[model samples]
Target chain A: MISRLRTALIYVVLGLGALVMVAPFLWMFTTSFRPVAEAFTLPPRWLPGLDSSLESYRRLLASDVPIGRFFWNSTVLATTVTLGYVATTTIAGYAFARLRFPFKNALFALLLVSLMVPIQTTLVPLFLLMRWLGLVDSQWSIIVPGLTGAFAPGMSGVFGIFLMRQFFLTLPKELFEAARVDNAGHFRTFWSIAVPLAGPQIAALSVIIFTMTWNDYFMPLIFLNSVDQMVLPVGIMSIRDPVGNSSATSEVIAAVSLSILPVLLVFLVAQRWIIDSFVRAGVKG
Target chain B: MTSIANDAAAGWFSPQNRKETIAGLLFIAPALIGFAVFVAGPMAATVVLSLMKYDLFSNPSFVGLANFEAMLDDRRLWKVLGNTAFFAVFAVAGNVGLGVVLAVLLNRNMSKTVQYAYRAAYFFPSLVGLIFVAVIWQFLFQRDIGVINYYLGLVGIEPVRWLSSARNALWSVIILDIWKNVGFAMLIATAGLQSISKDYYDAARVDGSSSLRTFWQITLPLLSPTILFLLTMNTIGAFKVFESIVVLTNGGPGDASRSLVMYIYEQGFKSFNMGYASAISLLLLTITVIVTAIQFALSKRWAFYE
Candidate 1:
């Protein structure tokens, strides 16, 4: 009976911490549905009236803020980065794990060292290069930098490569060997055999890429300057300055809610596999 | 047999070897090119740019160490550096501490339903954007109508200026960061905890060791690698903190909560001082490298990698 009480107490304790953990989310979700002034009200309304429920969202969508355009930009940018990252990392990582090439280990070591350097060091130069190339204020500037490299702003290329390599290493060597013995080229074997078996790993990689790209603020904030070019994070910032007048809070909250929901859905549905993939990759922030 | 042995010895470009080399290079070419342009090329350019004053609007002019020398007289730079360090040390400690504690609690024999629920709640913030995190918290930290102040009222404490007061501003940033990141740290710790075999705990139980004693002696040593990993990543993340500060404080009530990266952005973009920004970023890079190197070196004594 004492043990049962202890378990009950532990549950209460754990549940309290979880409440703190999810408080902002709860607040955001609740606030997103109400009028701006309702947020500052004393007891904090948890349930909105049916009329106020979609008021903030409608205000944001219909406002001159161009939020819908931002969402489209984010979607296109994220999808392209995901596809580019998946294609590049899968092939490169596969070669690192399964093929014997000159200076292969050295190249992988170089990738590891590349991860250690922070992006701040490269920011000025990348900006300069983009300006020199006349790509500044273009979406391509944001996309190109994130599309490749070990420390892309959209996602970590080194992590993706390492994940794919680790996954590839687990597949039987004979699968590739069998194809090779039949006079198949590496690409042919990789396409016809290896890629088919790596569905879960690819999905994990794509999920990570998509989410990271969707939330990427730094690259877009720096590389793209136009209102039309704005991605969600930066676009929303333009819409709602932190110390804006009292009337802006609910709309900002609504914008934030819409921005996060897609990634939240992905997280909620795939929490298990996502966490496992992160742990397996020994993820870095 | 002799001919075959000679062929093996002489063939540096055997058909299979050539095929392997060609295919491997072809496969990895995009990654290699990307590394060159984005990472290696920029790194090299950062060094050169630090020695030249080339604002985006101006023609390039060579400056001989003037930017680095200017660092000696820069008051704001020093202040922001100190601010970043304070933020890094506390935020990393708070994150890793909360993460480990939560990980340990969840690792206890518990119902699966409760376990999954708590895990998702903690991890949900990590999925949200940092900018959104600041937006959400900005409401909660509002002095008059804010739920935080409302709760503090019940506890008999006065409402504190969370993001506006210089003394309290950095702490607010740290708190916001720790809240968003604790879940991530917890997830990593949970992963580390799960990997630990059940046999060690069984042995500890049979030995009649107290739970605290078992935790210190067995669990801690075994978990050192994960802790070390958390320390390195969290420290680096804290050093690179940007969007949250941009949204929430904008370096704040004064220059109280400005970070190294924020300063770099201000100099490079705001003031158009590319040369000085490059110099400061090099400082940022050096400090991060030294700190992580120290962490790994220290881990040599305690980390129990399997």
Candidate 2:
């Protein structure tokens, strides 16, 4: 009887905590369906009942947000960045992991340190460089810089190479030896053998990069000046001018819901894979 | 012998292979060059610019540590730094505490499906960009029409101007930040919990230990490594807090929420005082490195990586 009581207590505490964790999102869901006036009704309407309407969604769709254009831009930009990152990081990661060359450790060290340097420090020089290349306000500026997988020699992604290298180092040397005996070159062995076997790491890296790029706002905010080029996060910012007198609460909530839902869905679908990768990597490597 | 000959013919060391190496470099060149120009080059520039005096258009003239001298004398700089430290400490502590509690709860074997759904819902806030989250919370905390006040009205509590008062604004921002990021800390901690073997719990039960006692004596001790690592990451992130402040409070009503990064952005971009801004950025970076180093040094005492 005591044990059962303890178990029930644990469940109650856990359930209450989980409710707090989920409350804001539930409030978001409730408010999105609520009319402007009804959003803050007495006693606080916590859920969407019969009176809940789709008006906010309609307003979001009908607003000057160009929600479709923003979505397209985000998709294209994220895809391009992810693909570019994969191609670059794979070769670079493999080289750092397996291949031998002069100053390899030194170069890799430089990359690691660069990863530590925050983006704010480099914004001015990067802006100037972009202006020099006449690439400011263009998609290429975002895509090209993003191609720098694991960040630059001096910031964010030096660890990318390290993570990938850890995985690569664990592969059996016998596979490489056998390939070499069969007259396969390094490149051929890498593609035919290593690449095919590296499905999990690739998936892990791709998902991480996709999520990073998807949630990125600062880079796009600084670079893309026009409405047509605005990504979802930045596009959403233009909805309510911070100084405007208009009540943009409902519209902004709809935009937030739209921006969040897709990524949340992706994360849900890939949660198992993500967790698996981390566990395997953390334990074995 | 045939394969050996082919290996020789393929010539891994041949002049042609050097060209292939160059091509490989070419394949990775875009990323490499971008990194060099944008990240490395700019960082070096920031360091150099910090030593000089420039206001955007004019060529920077080296002032030989004047920027640093100015930063030391600037009272506003110190205030912002204190605010940032306070924010980082509280926010990190709150998230870490909340994360551990949630992880412990979810670690149980029953009701796993409901737990997963709740985790997803919590993580949804983090999926949206910081600015968007700010927008939602801005309305939620508004003095008049906010749902928070609406609920408070029932309890006969007067509406509070959450973002208007100097004393309340910073705390409100911190609360928003804690809510935004607690889910992330929970995920990391939960992942750590999943890695722990069930044998630990079983052994404790065999020894006649209660569940709470088992958690305290076993689980928390074992989870120290993950907690340490996550604490370091969370502290660093909280120190760099910017967007939410920018959107919600704009470092007002009276510079209450003016964090170090916001100050850097304002000085650098808004006022175009590149030299002064670079100095502030350097100070912020120094604080980050110092704090991270201190954490690493102290982690040796408790972080239990096998």
Kept native contacts, fraction for each prediction: 0.69, 0.33
Output per-candidate TM-scores for chain A, rounded to 2 decimals.
0.93, 0.89
Q: Give the Cα-based TM-score of candidate 2 against the true structure.
A: 0.89
> Can you write out model 2's per-residue Cα lDDT over A1-285, one digit (the tens) per residue?
986898788777766766765666667778788876566555556678888888888877887679889889888988888787776777777777766444567777777666457776666667667778888888778887667773521126655566677778889877776886776766887789888888778887777677778777777877788999988888887776552333366777777788778776776787656655644554432
Best by lDDT: 1
| TM-scores, each model vs. reference | 0.95, 0.89
Q: Candidate 2 clashing pairs?
A: A114-A154, A114-A155, A115-A154, A115-A155, A115-A156, A150-A157
Candidate 1: regions farther than 4 A off: A36-39, A49-51, A242-244, A283-285, B1-12
Instruction: Compose the digit string of candidate 1's lDDT tens values, residues B1-306.
Output: 232121334443686367766888889888888888888898889988899897878787899899999998999999999999999999999999999888887888667777788888887788778887888887788787677888899999999888789988888888999889898888898878888899999999999998889889888888888998899989988889888777778898688888889999999999999988998989988977887888879888868976
Give residue A49's lDDT in candidate 1 (0 to 100).
Answer: 57
Positional deviation of A123 in candidate 2, in angstroms?
2.4
lDDT of 2 by residue, B133-182 (tens): 67778877888767688878789999988988898888888888878877
